[model samples]
Target: MDIDRKKSTYLTLGILFMILLSLIRWGGETLQYLFYLRVPLISGALLFMLPIICIYLLPSMLGNLFVLKNKWRMSLVIPGAVATGLGIVIIGGIIGTNAAARFNVSPCPLLEALLQDDALTPYLFALILAFPTAWAAYWSSGPASKEMSNTDRKIGVAIGSILSLLLMGAIYWARTGETVSWVSDMLLMIISILPSEARAGLVKDDQLTPGLVTASAFLAVSTILYLIGLLLYRPKIKKDRWQLPALSYVLGLLLIFSFLFGLLTFVLDYYRVPVLLSFLAVSALAYKLWKVDHYYDIRPTPTEPPKPDDFIGALKERLAHQQGRRTLVVVCASGGGIQAAGWTSMVLTGLQKRLGKDFTQAIGLISSVSGGSVGTLHFLDRFGNEGAPEDSELNAIFNASTEDSLGATGWGLVYPDLWRFSGLPFLHTQPRDRGAAIETDWKSFMKSPNATLRDWVDPIKQGKLPVPVFNATIVEDGRHYLISPMTFATEPLEGLEFNRLYPQHDMDASTAALLSATFPYVTPITRNSEEDDSQSKVTPVFHVADGGFFDNFGIVSAVDWLNEQVLPKRVELEIERVLLVEIRAFPDEEPLQTASRKNVGFLMSLFGPLLTVLAARNSTQAQRNEDIVNDLKTKWTAKDIDIFDFKISFPKNIPFFEIPTQTGYENIDQYTTALKDEKKAYTPPLSWTLTKKQKDAIRNAWEILNQDQSSSVAELEKVWSRK
Candidate 1:
């Protein structure tokens, strides 16, 4: 066959294969829903094998059959016989079912009905259709005398098109009943899953007339077939490829317009007028500021005072001595869901295990957000209490706290009766206060009571653990707020006051941790009294949510602190490279794209512009982060600042661990034993601890750090010789 003909044939077969696979999957799901079939092994194996055979193997085999001259006759005969047999079985099953129903006769249960009662009809029909298409191609490829005439070829194409249309009609009829419109059915499915508020304007009633069903079904089938025909008979590929660019531009515009419309609708629907007007006002003000080239001058907080007794001064003096030389290892944790906490803990534990006690000592700063804060604070507490623990001890601590810290209870919300009835509540909550239950539980587990900021200050003063800084975002102001122990540790401690320089007030460790990790919607927003009463005398409280709202991973903050604060102070013997270890929890999949035709996919596409904006913003932020790092790298080539970004995704379908509770003092020993057993089993396999992607990241970072260290030593030796 010629290249053009071969290409056309492959394209046709590929489309057919995709359609068949979708039908097969839909059929299997429908069957499972209609009749609770438990053929897990059989269904899984068939679902896996069908795509390989139909899409890949069969296409290659058919291509070879068409190309081979002499072997074409035999190839046609084999497929023809298989097709004939499948057709017979399908027809026989239909006939037998009709006859049995007409005669009021039932088939024997033991003997069974024709090949599982036509369950394989869809597959058989797909195979049978392929045989005739292959035969037509072969006939067309034959010698001049044997080749089909123009009229015959036209008729053949018409017949194939008609058959495809009919098949689609039949599938639609089977999927949606005579009294239900397919579009309405789909909308109903979406409505069932959507929240109560979103159900407005959607078809609430599923009732539809037979005529409407038939018309809608026909329209739906015709639309699908038209699209398929367009794909098959698409305009020929031109050398200039002028159409490609135009097509892309049009699609891009459509996507942008759709996204904007969706976003505007959502803003109007959710926040109503005042918030939207406020946002618009802000945008106008920002635009005016930008026009004057003074937008960047609007600082969120006042500049830091040049006090030698401040935290930065303390850090500078501590690192002034050569013996006290340290690398300010700033660990930025990424926010995902509950899995983020687990992954963060695992990453930190792994780092400590591989790099040893010195690694812990070198880490002078730790900044985290949401789930990352949970893991960071947990590790700091453990390290302070137990020093640099062995691998086993670290693993045990992680396992024990992983469930309570990352589970639903960690959100400080009470679950419904069903959740408790299913014994999931124990894993998530403690018997104490319902709100901030996770914080209470964590405090109890650590055997530490909630202490004022002064308690934490003594440690940093004595050079015990690193200065822990957690981040949260204020919703109303739309600014990133940094919470640290030092920020709250005032000399003349009086009434709580929000400092203009620090922009954060002193709170207990539990509240600080909870505020830092308070994910929006999941955990309720925290309301705290502010010292400044200028705004309003009635309510002078600030609302704080998850730090992820402003900076999800703490990457930008880490770099900013390193350059603007640490480097300028000339900390360490000579400021060495600022190493950033970011642990991400999300998978390495393409963002914002969803499969077509799915309800969720449809919703996502409708709101595509919002996602696009978010994606663009993230990309820009990442570029800015890289620019900052690159700037440091250029200026401090000797120190060699480096970044190691690692992501560890949670394994699919892993069940949450269950925790045991005590009934009374008599069963305390049993509960304790069960808890130990649970902890032991809670630890997943080593393979699950770190994915290959994460391992590679860790290895690369280790190599970079070692290389820089070696280079620094060589430079020092040369300087010493000169001296």
Candidate 2:
């Protein structure tokens, strides 16, 4: 074949490849809307193609600007195409991940939300990304061959310019005929996804007119395309060796900076400070403590030491009489949304039955954060309450079907909308009213009818509950605020200082549980304000967000509370043994090291940093916990402190909603039949049964406690006989 003809054939194939890629990207979204939402197929197809054409033309125009010889230019083609495609995927992933995180939903749900809202900003951002992506592809393709005939080059430029104009014209024509105002539609869509309070001020009334704004935007975009086409017509082939390398360096730097900026913004928006800042603050605190050498004295002095007859003091005396044979059981549950909550309920139910009548009395402390608190709070509320059934009833309440747990009414589907509307500061008549709507529905689903906040607090205060249960939440200052019964105790110790932060506030068990269980964007941030007459302004609003943000499992807070408060006060009873029970929802899976060269994999890698941070934090906490346990074990031998970690694995295919429901015996029977009918489907193991897992965990706990108690008692008897 003639060299020119061969080159033309390759160019044509490249354009066809771009179209195929575009079709795959946008076509999937179009089909989803068409089948699921019943969006007009024609409209969906047309809407989908608009972005495709825009993206497809970008690489074509970029490739045409370069005039290169056969082998070198062809080599550039593959690299350019891959770079552009990968760039789009990576950028989309970053956008989608941030959006999902901000909205507190999964990526698929966030995409659906954007589609339903008809949000244009995401599309516009994609369009904006195309320019740099196209440029990167163009640069990789190498400079146009200076040896090419002028005639052939002119012909290529004319073809490209005409095609670009035609494509732009078609997009504009299709957009203009639409009844929906795309600009205002997009603005409203963006506002809808924002938190309720932020939505009102996002756009002004003047910005609501779609026609003028849309026209202006269309004109600006068309002009930019036209200019780029003009540049392609008169190709500038940089022959200077240094120039291309310098340009590549600049482009790479810009891309890296852009990614870093995005990451910083994401961290700051969610955490109210940069991750680095948080890290530095933690380091500084550690340094300050080290410098003090005797930092324990820095803690506030307690109002008074407890007499032997007082609450904790009496408990200490009882344990002393038992000759250190009493087990100090500390249960630490991790957060994993509603699934974790169900697991917690299962574990607690098993513990209750295993302990028999002494279920409430045997528990030393139940420390939890996020979803785990939901079950812990519920259990504490109903444990010894009148008319509350012991085991099966608890399971029924916690492991209820999704319809029953969330709500049978369709209103549950719009629970997110409630979070949006109810978060508005102006709309809320009272501070509690801010989250009241969503909280009411959530509490209805999760709260135990007999569990009052007082039930959890009263027991701890009166020493009926051995040690106060620790429920943690992250306040505005990015610190863990421990909400325990001791928070309200008359102690002036630093451990109880967090309670003073929200003084006079009635923190019912349900409310505290709700606050601790708040899972970022899923639950609205609870804001409380107080007027400061002296300053002539309301004091800085105190925001209570997710406890998981600070400590997902409450292990850190539990250990801190034990070391700082409980141990110091109990002079007669040293923590001879510590049993840490950790309940995890999923089995430990291998980390991703090598990803497939696919768009989904590329997108997933965008969350690598976030996953790393979470993994590191969990690992650090686990190590710290082990260190505490080891210190006790080394001092009193390995029999002193034992950590019982339980990881309950459910079938990966089981939907999160179904996991909780499947825990109940009736639900299990129904699911089992369903699984049989679909033989290829994953059948959940019998161990996945919530009650069974709970029983297993409790039985394990008992064995550990009994073994330690037996050994300690035997040692005590030996000493007594010798004396």
Candidate 3:
């Protein structure tokens, strides 16, 4: 049974036992108190709470009746027999008073007159008290006698009987004034303190019992033994030790008794001595066991080597055969910046294949540096919660999932358009759509086969390059390397404003070299709002402090130069030239003409879903949101640091000078008419417009030129012309 059930059962049993004891004592004491002057029932109940009364005497009554099986041995039985004889003496004394004249004997002043006589002196008085009280201690030992073995029980009873008879004989002698002694008085005092004296009502008479000395001695010796036994009876899982069952019962009874009566336990405590001592001893043993085994290696088989795969093909086969409900692809970069893009492509493809086309699944792209712009979108798509990346669960998922040490590769695919194009910091093409960019970058890397450049450029290549790409922006401000794209975008202007910035204002030779070297792969494609309808085609290229593309459009050499020279000197250049720039440009200065490539509004919207998917890759909803926000902000803010918000606008034939100027004198209609006239004047001839075939050839030539040395541009031109 559980502890509750056991406690309930015990509680019921205890209540019943208390009731039974109360009833028996109530009847006996109520009747006695009616005949006597005191309320015996209440007094007996109070006395029962005492150690001598309850702990010892109650059991003695039962032993006397059942175990001893002798009615004559009861103190009440012998006392009743002698009471009739005492009455005869009292009657004779009264008769003597009545017949004082006839018998010539006055009543002995009731019994007091006779007791005052020299014949009934102090010594005799003490003897008289000792005689009846000696039986109290003798009977008190009777209950314990019953618990002994058969042999001990018989001997104890015989000894008890002899002591009882001897005490009774002494009482008879005292009644006749025969046993008068100091020793008897001392013995009487000893007996009165015993449980039997309290049981028999002798102690209540104010009589000094001689058994007090012996009882006190027994109590002292038992207390010492109790302490010692407690010390010895420790809990060990062995035959010689105290068992849990017996100990529980003993402790339980003590607990109940303490609750019922305020059994105050202090320094000289009688309870819990054994339990505490045993607990201490057991604790010591446990400590020793722990010390001995602390360093022991209980674990089996010290080491197990992993089985080596014999054939790579077989391993692949086995891997393919294993059935999994879900598959996870991990990505890792230097700081996990490029990993986001890789994850985006994988997730999109996986979802498309698994769910089919036009599936209404939302994709997210997140950056490690930025918070949860991406993941938040994903959450809205999935669970529809709108908490920011930092405080949201999405952020945690993104951070927790980006473990770079796990052999996951980052997606840093730099496409040709990214390298050749100018303006926006870092490669920005979506991996799924950068076909021309990827093909050109791949050819360049293949043709060059330069390890140093390959390692550096591969990460920036927004193609099928198996390297991680980071979101690095050399904004006009040039200060701290703010890793988060989102924070950089949304972050308040710390040092400089946009209008004061200039890209080529004070360009130095080394700075020029760095810019020239990195311009190819890090170019930002200009997209004129009127000329380009396919706005989605434009991608971001990597830039550096030298105000040039690391890989303009798709030129690997430019990316190599930025990575090798410009990036290494990025910090130095930023410190000296940036200080000069900041000193030169003020927030109020003419806003440096920003390139028109701010088409990020539409591009951002277009790739927003893709970015969200990228963020969600290898992360939960919460993480995806965080990554997207962070990446977006970082890329956006990079404009200030790199200072090259070069707009990717479509090429236009009309020059800035050719456009009509608006003056206060010109009304709205007049200005409109002038612009229309200029437009008509500048209209291109139909013959000059390139054919579809020509455009394709030019595009193909651009791709071939972007390659290093392997693919010939001439060959590409020939094919394009023939097609």
Q: Tell me the whole-model lDDT of each prediction, alpha carbons only.
A: 0.44, 0.42, 0.26
Q: Give the TM-score of candidate 3.
A: 0.14
In model 2, which residue pairs have backbone atoms overlapping below 3 Å? Answer: 67-144, 67-145, 68-145, 453-509
lDDT of 2: 0.42
lDDT per residue (tens digit) for residues 1-723 in model 1? 579978998999999999768756863433322211112222223323432342234432111122112232223323322322232233333223222222223432321243342244534543553454344343422321123344454454455445544554464454365434457576466556756554432222443211223324434543454344234322221222111111111112222222223323322333244533555566556436543110000113233422324556455433333243345556777665444655677667766765556555656667777777766666766655323445556765455334322222321222221233222333322222222544554555453445534456656655555666677777677677766665533232211223433343345565666677775444556565333455553324566777777777766566656655566655433545455566665433344566455445567879888877877766775566657667765765555533333333333222222222332235444644543333222222111122222233333433343345343222322332231
Q: Cα RMSDs of all predictions? A: 23.3, 22.4, 41.2
**Candidate 3 positional error at 590, Å:** 87
Clashes of 3: 114
Looking at model 1, residue 674 earns an lDDT score of 40
TM-score of each: 0.43, 0.46, 0.14
Runs in model 3 lying further than 4 Å from the true structure: 1-211, 236-240, 244-723
Clashes of 1: 0
Segments in model 2 whose C-alpha atoms lie over 4 Å from true places: 1-311, 314-324, 385-393, 396-435, 445-456, 466-470, 473-475, 488-497, 529-541, 569-576, 589-611, 632-723
What residue runs in model 1 are displaced by over 4 Å at the alpha carbon? 1-309, 312-326, 385-393, 405-435, 488-505, 529-540, 571-573, 587-606, 638-723
Give the per-residue lDDT of model 2 (tens digit) for 279-346.
45655565365431100001222243222224355345324333444545567776765555665666
Per TM-score, the best of the predicted structures is: 2
